[model samples]
Target: MNKQPGTSGLIFNEPLLWDKSREGRCAVSLPKPDVERADLEKDLIGDAPELPQLSELDVVRHYTRLSQWNFGVDSGMYPLGSCTMKYNPKTNEVQAARQGFAGAHPFAGEEFSQGALKLMYNLEQYLAKLTGFDAVTLQPAAGAHGELAGMLMIHAYHAKMGKQRSKIIIPDTAHGTNPASASLCGYDSINIKSGDNGILEPLAVAAVMDEETAGIMVTNPNTLGLFESNIKEIADIVHSKGGLVYGDGANMNAIMGIVKPGEIGVDVLHFNLHKTFSTPHGGGGPGSGPVAVGKTLEPFLPVPRIVKELDSYKLVTDFSDTMGRLHTFYGHFGVMIRAYAYILSMGGKGLTDASKLAVLNANYVKESLKGTLNLPYDYPCMHECVFNDEFQKEYHITTMDMAKRLLDYGFHPPTVYFPLVVDSAFMVEPTETESKEDIDQFISAVKAIAKEAQENPEKLKKAPHKTKVTRLDEVAAARKPCLRG
Candidate 1:
């Protein structure tokens, strides 16, 4: 068999840019200023800033080597559960970089920015249709932002009906941020536990859902990667109590064309464009989380909403019931452009196929590694699977140990110790982007590590021997962080 792709090769150790600085070196050559330098106020121009000085080649090599040290979806399989770090088509980036879209000013009048407006309008329409929602606002900046928007709108809906509820029902299986979003909108979170099958039970929801509760926040194909089959019943219960259902579309990659959240009793849904559609994500974003709502919640969507007025689109904020502006401007325009390009490029059929493949890939990983790892939820997963370290307990190994060992085999580790429900959780999600061969290699690497856990358990404790940096004392680092270099 071929060696794993993550095998260490000749790695270059690059020092900090400041460490390589030389007093007289410079990366660029410029002609003497033809115009006189303008004087700046002493306060405006602080003491000449400290900076690194280096030649052009020095700067180039420094960054080039640094890039090699980093791992991304482009580097190898990034099986991060709930984080769809798939390989987005490069064409999406190309479209986003076009001068007209890239250079359009945020403050440009609608007439001058017709193309941008039209794109936004059409993107909203597309998302609305895909999720089976009546209206969509591309204003929330991220998944959590969208959650807050949905909760605020729900609160507003209740207020308009002459009663503002004080609590929202959140299942433990929902996204971790669901409670935080509800709390941000002044609604106390009524936390409910999912049933033994890793999904919310209608009866459990019925037990606490009342007129005092605003609504329920659910993540379809939740963090555990299991679909809540009783969602329709749960939604009916919430609706009967004059409450709405908020769906977290973070895992929309699993059911894009298969099931629309709107048709499933969801009153409001938010799409993580960076996850569901293809867009750059991570590193604190540049993320887009457009919120979609059914007709009941449409009036409270964030404004100024983009509307088409006979061939020309305009931004209108006249709705008195709007949740008000969430972002300074339209959510991340670059992310929107990239997402729009992705949707256009991948028609409905293509997207459905992507979801199917994503689900298939995750199940493949789950079945392949179940023998080597402990799959806490041994049912069919949607686009990810949850595993625990129970099987490795006898070997005196742990999930973190196995995760660190993956680095030595040249593969990025799956998400470890998450979903919080499972002890020593190791969540893996091989998105549709990965091929069977690549996934098999990842499985092999994991199995090899498991074997090592039994025979050479001590070594697993000090794993990732090939990386530039070794295992860190994460606890100490978190407690006594080094604020300065």
Candidate 2:
């Protein structure tokens, strides 16, 4: 398998689609309208909207060349901590592209849609079993979308109890989307700082825990790549004040088989099917995040959950107080199809091994780079590891410099300056999919970078010499984005 796709010598100056337009060239030809030309002459035919006109070969070559310039999991290891950016199995894509599933329309009646509904129902049951939830909803399109639905249900639960809870307690180590979800539900987010151990303690939560709090949002294996050992105690404290506990399942890949959030006292949680289940990720893609809940909050899950009727499946909505529909129809059916295929192919043991290997690989890298880099936590990580620029700080080297230099090493850079707890953070997650050889190369590259930083600090300061472009002004790009030419 070639990591870098080769390009042909054929070149056309890389013109934009609009620039390729000619007098009347078109890749498609439409039959003349069935009605007379006079019918559309007055209004519809006044002027033709501007559209690119190109031959079929022209369009194909243009996109193919653009795709060659991009990198994906298939190209190499994408070790972005907390993202679970693992390799997507080609089998999933094959299963998703099957004509029956691909061509099926959502508006088709239940009788014509039995296969589709049954697949959704089966996937929901698999998720419920895995996460120990009473029920699940496949309505949310993505992870953050699932968060919104979960928070809305939490809001509805308290509203039904006649409690006007206005605040949601979130740990500082939780994902950035946690607070945004709470705020979307018209609740204020109260962020509490974690202790020195990078784990959120129950005592710290208890101080901020109050009757006005709607619930607490937490990531079990938090963004710092450390599991919150006091989660059960933290959940108890929140429950004592009659508040729910929402688990952000972004890190579920770390503890998929070893632990279940619902069994561990989480009232509600969501699953990033694309992340944990090995479906396609990123690119504003077709993603699914199914929200699961205990029986207490199950009534408020999005309406029209799938149910089995003897042998057939049906879409039914019957509950106490619902939050209504999050999507017009079942969300991202294609993504769900691919996810279901991944689960059946992997089975139970395979899934367990995936999580175990993820943890093992992360720990291996953490230990290997301990002295060369700066190990901030100095402990076993779940499915990812974190390091600061302590060793590089001596030579005035920064994490950004290290990240940029990784491109020259023939690897995508790990996430930088994140979790916002450690200074000059370098977060890396080598998912279970990578081979030992890939991991070794990553470690060697970092070790070389560390040596370079010590011996010649100037090389670290102005890095990424091998790439087509040198270091970019990210500050300028962020503060003053050029939207259009």
Candidate 3:
């Protein structure tokens, strides 16, 4: 495909709908008013809202076009590392949208919503057993929310023991959410740098442990895609210092059935169902992040936990020291339904096989791109692989340039300059759902970009010429957000 050069001004086929509005032109005629209510106070009322006046078809076509511009797992391979943008099975969607599940109100009585409650209860048990944790709470809306809930549980656990721990330790390569969650929970985050090969050493953690340390937040097979082989030692060190171990289970897809965080001595962990389980992720979610805890931290779980009785299930709202409620209702129940469907559909062996295949896919991509890119770590990876821009630096090309050029080839780029540990990191996660052909296509695109970077650096710098939108002024967009049309 020949790529277009330079920018074009915003162009649209239809005139601005606002320009076509007449004083009394209405999209639809309303029925006669049955009753009139008293108007609000003048101060409470704003001037007439400036809404675009468009016919129904105009609005539909505009949104349809906008939706087409979106890139998703359904569209193609999304190699976003740690974000596991895998294909969400359509069957899960069918189950989620079933009237018996989707149409139920959150405020419905427990007795009336037995099926929904049972699904939630069974899901908690399944996840707890799968993760080797004593209890699970599905109150967190997303992975980050789950992290905050886990930290709060840790905080409450220490407070109950009459201990005053004020710091939470996280590896430098940990997700951005780890520190953010700690800060939100009134705990200071102590960042420990990982070793040169992207693994956090046990001794580094042990050296930093003090009486004030709450726990260590570890992301095994961490952001750099290297497993933390010293996890047992690290967990023991934190435990010896009276600090708990918090596992950020964002990368849980890599080790789903192979290992359980609790078995490795992690006291608390958050599961990103949207990432690991086949849940749709977009539009800031509707994501589920159920937190599982060991026996020690079970009492501090969030309120309204589902309890299965003799023949039925019930919701428990009262607790001695619960973390209150992390969400308005049991966090995103429909999302939980989808995840539950995924879990049951996959079964035990299927889950393990999925993990193995995911690891295999990632390794395949890693090995394929090794010579064309700079692999930061030498050892085998889990579900993702990390590469740096050292190979392209000689040509004055950057990871961003390569990423932008990928759009021209009809592929979304891997996450770039992340993990913050590497200089120009390009972390790729070719999920298990992608076929060998899809992987090869991505590999070919990346290889072509690498070649172009050396032969025609300027083309890479002015890349993504085929995308619907060209390069954006990201800094300006952040500073002056234009949210409205």
Summarize candidate 2's per-residue lDDT along 376-455 as a digit string, tens digits: 78878999999988988879999999888887777888999897988888999999999888888888888888899889
Top model number, TM-score: 1
Q: What TM-score fits each model? A: 0.97, 0.91, 0.91
* Best candidate according to lDDT: 1
Once fitted onto the true fold, the runs of candidate 3 whose alpha carbons sit more than 4 angstroms away are: 1-60
TM-score pick, better of 1 and 3: 1
lDDT of 3 at 57: 66
RMSD of 1: 1.7
Superior by TM-score: candidate 1 or candidate 2: 1
Candidate 1, residue 399: the lDDT equals 95
| Order of candidate numbers by TM-score, starting with the best | 1, 2, 3
Count of residue pairs whose backbone atoms collide, per candidate: 1, 0, 0
Worst 10 residues of 3 by lDDT: 1-10
